[model samples]
Target: MMEREARRTPPELQELTEQLSLRWFGRPFIHEAVYNPRLRTTGGRYMLRDHSIQVNPAVEMMYGEEELIGVLKHELCHYHLHLEGRGYKHGDSDFRELLRKTGSPRFCKPLQAEQQRTVRHYRCADCGRQYERRRRVDTSRYRCGKCRGKLQEVQ
Candidate 1:
């Protein structure tokens, strides 16, 4: 099945961010909104120094508008609070309150493009020792450390 593309242009994203800010937070988002290709698992991030919001391109491309909006809101919570000299950190009360008020998710979903872990299970043929590895082990060359037994693939 094909995934829907929800990627927005930079200008469109900026407009959306501004609209959301005015609609929910009752403040204008003055800083720029830009897509960041380098952002992997993170949906969005608000730069403390530049006051700019960087959004992961994968948010909309893989997730959808709702997820993208949620990421935007999450970053906005950090943006507004930090600019006002209030508690903007995840641990702070103000940040938590804003998140609650805005209904923004505390964390973004993991990227769909992220590689899934490959776990290889192995057992010693002689000693019955078990081992889990990310990569395949050469059973012919590698021996069990415990009993120096030959290892066999479990699955």
Candidate 2:
């Protein structure tokens, strides 16, 4: 389940789960759902080892609850289908069908709030071409690929 660390209460989670389950699966989710802080890169994951659902808190923190709910539904597709002995794996027919049937999101999209933010800027020493990056580049190790020239930081 993916609601234990959730900012939402048990009752809220239960309600949310029910609503999503019904809206997507047309069936009730009878198990626990929880928020997992250790998740990374991925939006959510199903514990094949334990049958519990682990949702990335970053899904909500970065993307918001709507996307978080989508992540839940995506995981639920695995949860309910697995519990019912249906295709739970992503490549399985049942899983694919369920995704379409429930309108659950297939991919957990990242938050775009900072899409325009720039952290590092670079200039080509030879051509003065400019490049922007979100991470710092090692000037000693990196060279401008376009002009095969040295790159310098511009503020």
Candidate 3:
């Protein structure tokens, strides 16, 4: 995977976060920015507990620096706003204004890992109801929601 090929050192991410914070927000980033491989969809996350940021390594490896920077900016918005005791979440007016002012993305682009998912189809034996799911469903342990009928996989 690209995530394995182009892994960034923690210091590099931290430095970038600090630089962007200072340049744009006019404040120092006192917390850490570490790569977390377990992040599946979102590019980065700001921890409320320690005021730290966790970035997905796959973002830099798969997309590049521009995408990484956008993620950083988004997370930094959360960090700085939270520190200032302002609205920091996506739905907040302060967060929205900050994103627009900084030209930061409101949301991260969907990850490639999520695009190639295969949908599994199933049908209820008695009701003829159909269902689609991202994962395989065990018929023995599950039933159709509508009519409480046995579900059978449909090819």
Candidate 4:
């Protein structure tokens, strides 16, 4: 059996989140804020049950402090609005208005590493058509769409 190591939440992260809460939303953050290393795609997420905020540590490491702050602000918007019985979801009008009022970003910038992912290339044996995919495809199971030719991986 393998045990996963626990990652400690930095004290400064809590302090920064609290400060941003008061500075931007003019309200105190009474909940916890921690860095979650398991977050792969999203910059941050606000938990409705615990009212806590989980920030992806990679956002700061990959994009820097400015991007991190933007993520925090965006999450903070959801925090304040939800607590006040207002719209907190991205599709809600109140959420959009608050985002505009707070000057928080609507979307976080894509991580640099995510943009540099290697793409797999494939070609059809008969049609000579090419395709690019992020994940590998089974040549035996899949075939060309146009010419119904067998697909061969390229490099």
Candidate 5:
């Protein structure tokens, strides 16, 4: 993945933020916007401490720039409204309305590369054979591929 500075919203995010801010909030985003690698399990977040937006780098690395722009818009909604002293929280009415008005997505998909994606573990019910797979195996029909015994999950 690119460094967080390189990931700074990109040229597309910059343009999208400029347009969205003008259309939805009647202002411009003047602060630095960049991805923070430490953020896990979230699409984006606005830093109240600096008024900067920290987007999860996983978004671009996994979903591409188009989806990342949507997240940018979402964060910008918080940025603009907060700077103006309007209700800017996720549960606030103003925030919700601004999100809808800007056509921003509420959630983003988890990047498969971000963590362990799948695990299938089983053990034999009959002979105590254990099995582990990335894909699930049929418990009713398929037995331990090695011992031909019933399989159960071990871990």
Candidate 6:
């Protein structure tokens, strides 16, 4: 039973989204909500063509139910505004106003995995100058700008 309850089924997620729509937006959600595991950088998104809400399953797994609810609310704001032919884009006044009125987050918190990314630190062999990069820098090809010294990976 633990495995069965490990994740919310698609139907349960759909129901939850619908309920949030009614409670927060004062309107019933007629669209679908599904888990999109491919979402790496975002917590959730509202699809304009299909009017569906795609949630990153990792949001709930890493941040808990409250955070998941916040993501849902953010997506719902976009959904309702777009359907009503109002300004739904992030930069629009209508979108910002609705977000403020509903207390929905303008942006979701960064995922733990994203926050904990390994940054490669490099040091100049001669000058001892330091550099940090998200991707590995080839020590053989790259040299330090300060003293034109050989770059070496640190730690």
- Winner on lDDT (4 vs 6): 6
User: What shift in Å separates residue 46 of candidate 5 from its native position after superposition?
Assistant: 0.2
lDDT for predicted candidate 4 compared with the true structure: 0.89
Per-model TM against the reference: 0.76, 0.62, 0.92, 0.84, 0.63, 0.82
Ranking of all candidate structures by their TM-score, best first:
3, 4, 6, 1, 5, 2
lDDT of 4 by residue, 13-121 (tens): 8899999999988899999999987887789999999999999887887667887899999999999999999999999999999999989999897765577789999
Tens digits of lDDT, candidate 1, 7-37: 6889999999999999889999999999998
**lDDT, candidates in the order shown:** 0.91, 0.78, 0.91, 0.89, 0.77, 0.90
Rank order (by lDDT, best first) = 3, 1, 6, 4, 2, 5
**Residues 71-155, model 2: lDDT tens digits:** 8889999989888998899999999998897778888885343344667889999999999888899989999988789999998
Give the poorly placed runs of model 1, Cα more than 4 Å off: 120-155
Give residue 56's lDDT in candidate 1 (0 to 100).
89
Best by TM-score: 3
Q: lDDT for model 6, on a 0 to 1 scale?
A: 0.90
Cα deviation in Å at residue 28, candidate 4? Answer: 1.7
Off by over 4 Å in 4: 1-9
Better of 1 and 5 by lDDT: 1
Residues forming the 10-long window of minimal summed lDDT in candidate 6: 1-10
Task: Report the error of model 5 at residue 89, Å.
Answer: 0.8
Clashes of 3: 0
Which tens-of-lDDT digit does each residue in 96-131 have in candidate 5? 998898888777776555466587889887777666
Best of the two (3, 6) by TM-score: 3
Tell me how many clashing residue pairs each candidate has: 0, 9, 0, 0, 5, 0
